[model samples]
Target: MDYLLTEEQKMLKEMVAKFAKEEIAPVAREFEEKGIFPQEIVKKLGNLGLMGVAYPPEYNGAGMDNISYMIAIEEISRYCASTGVIVSAHSSLAVDPIYRFGTEEQKKKYLPALCSGERIGCFALTEPSSGSDAGSARTTAKLIGDKWVINGTKHFITNGEEAEVCVIFAHTDPSQKTKGISAFIVEKGTEGFRVGKHEKKLGINCTSTTELILEDCAIPKENILGDLNKGFKIAMVTLDGGRLGIASQALGIARAAIEDSIKFSKEREQFDQPICQFQAIQWMLANMNTEYEASWLLTYRGSLLKDKGLPYSKEAAMAKLKASETASFCADRAIQIHGGYGYTKEFDAERYLRDAKITEIYEGTNEIMRIVISAAMLK
Candidate 1:
């Protein structure tokens, strides 16, 4: 579907593809193996205007559209899922909320550094008790004089260890339940705010998944994001955009699995013939390609809807659900095609499977996605 892309988007796809193949592919395994963050690669990505590809130039962004952003993520993920998600979580979860719902002052204060990637950013909404039920979050924030003091622990936060800016959610009025939730921007070194336990993940180990502890963490009252007590709406809208990023990441992982399988099929032999010659192998390859294309088109549709300023929540949900599942499916099939070699670390098939599993779990689970889509239809 190259013909579907604008010239600018095509160029971005090419540029990102070239960069990922050259820079990320070689080092991805090494970084993941050592559980080391790809700091240098992330920094170079920032230099390339990829850190903020979909934002405006005034905020140090590349001023591209959502499709362009999707293309960049997909290309980057093709080589390294960890690197793809570093960009996605930063751009979609943290940056999109601030850019879309933030006050002019908040935008000016945060967007420049975040968009430039001089400072990494994270969104802290998930707690020990709250994942899909975001409204059930137990984090508390109290207004005292000119400041809001927050107290809670957020777990499973991506980019938490290295993030300089964090958009965190807390209950400003617990009596009001979901309506009580409010968003705030807290700096990394703010008093009583600290990073906590780093999780040992199954994959995407090169990226940090850690806990954020806020014990009476105080920030200016003005740090509240969007309107007071409307954090739920803000979160829903933000997650809608974030879903597209995850969808693109899933597409990348699926493509990687499919492409690697194709290459491996030609090289690996069975019964004195290349495995690619087998009918079963041919069917598996065909299924993988078909599923991948379907997911890609769904993601692209969601991106287009978002770019056009239309309601894309359902589309985003549909895209994320399908893409994430497709990633897992393709990776699993790729492993099957590789036979015994795929089960080993010597081949990337196992890693692809591990990495693809998380896509179905994060941003919003596939179960949640179906609910969103069905609700939209039933409504």
Candidate 2:
């Protein structure tokens, strides 16, 4: 299938690419090195209508298509994977559920601030006990009177600290397994709600990754997202879209690695010739370019399929699995091409390698993606 960007979409891509180069690229290493969150930068991005790229303008979104959103993500991730994921987790995971399944009241209440970037958002699903088996979540949401009292511990939560709005998943009834799970909308500073156990990670450290402790945190029954006892479906759908965002991120990182490799090969001479002239370096560059192109095609296909209102689980899985693997491959190759310099923090090659790893693991692991793909094929 041939996918093409409209004139407006091309303009959107160029705009984000320029912003990434001028804004994100300059401070990306600084923030990653210092482990400081770019609060001001995120606000700037939000002002540019990037935080709500694919949502309707009525909800304070840019009203762009999913392909345009993917393009924006790819450009930002090319400069900083950490910042890229911050936007992805917020937009694809948090804002998405509310927009897709929320009541009109919920949308009016939350989307404005979330889309404005004045209030960040997070998705709370993974717990200390659960990762892949979301149905086995130990966190519980009980109906007490007219309110839902949530009691659970969610770990590895992206944007946990910064988010004012959280879309959380919990088990309302354990007996029914996954079918008993439910989703809720919880605001920050609710009584008994607390952030805990902040982690320092190998990559994406600039993004807030914290544990959420919700003990008897009560929200009105109206806060229930989608329908009761159908959170599994919501989570799956959210993940299908999130995978496309992550796949775009992987493509961005791969592109960055390849571009860096090419620049370094031309400047660093070996045997009195620029390494770009060497067949070995040339072949590595060629392979990196090819991998990036292939991954882009898959990711764009998933994005296009999503915008077209098609069932895209298999396509999203394919894009995420290949693009994530290709990211790691390209980062590793870039490091090899840079030799010892790539091993140090003076250059971004090592950071690229680190950032590429988590793409294989999160938004559902590559292993999970493989299962999704295989199941569809077999069916």
In order, the Cα lDDT scores of the candidates are 0.95, 0.93
Residue 366 C-alpha lDDT in model 1: 94
Give one digit per residue, the lDDT tens place, for model 2 in 218-256: 999899999999999999999999999999999889999
TM-score per prediction, in order, is 0.99, 0.98
Worst-scoring 10-residue span by lDDT in model 2? 1-10
Once all C-alphas are superposed, what RMSD does model 1 give against the true structure? Answer: 0.7
Predicted structure with the largest lDDT when compared to the true one: 1
lDDT of 1 by residue, 1-379 (tens): 8899999999999999999999999998889889999999999899999999999999999999999999999999998899999999999989999999999999999999888889999999999999999999999999999999999999999999999999999999999878999999999999999999999999998999999999999999999999889998888999999999999999999999999999999999879999999999999999999999999999999999999999999999999999999999999999999999999999899999999999999999999999999999999
Best candidate according to TM-score: 1
List clashing residue pairs in candidate 2: none
- What are the runs in model 2 whose C-alpha is more than 4 Å off? 1-3
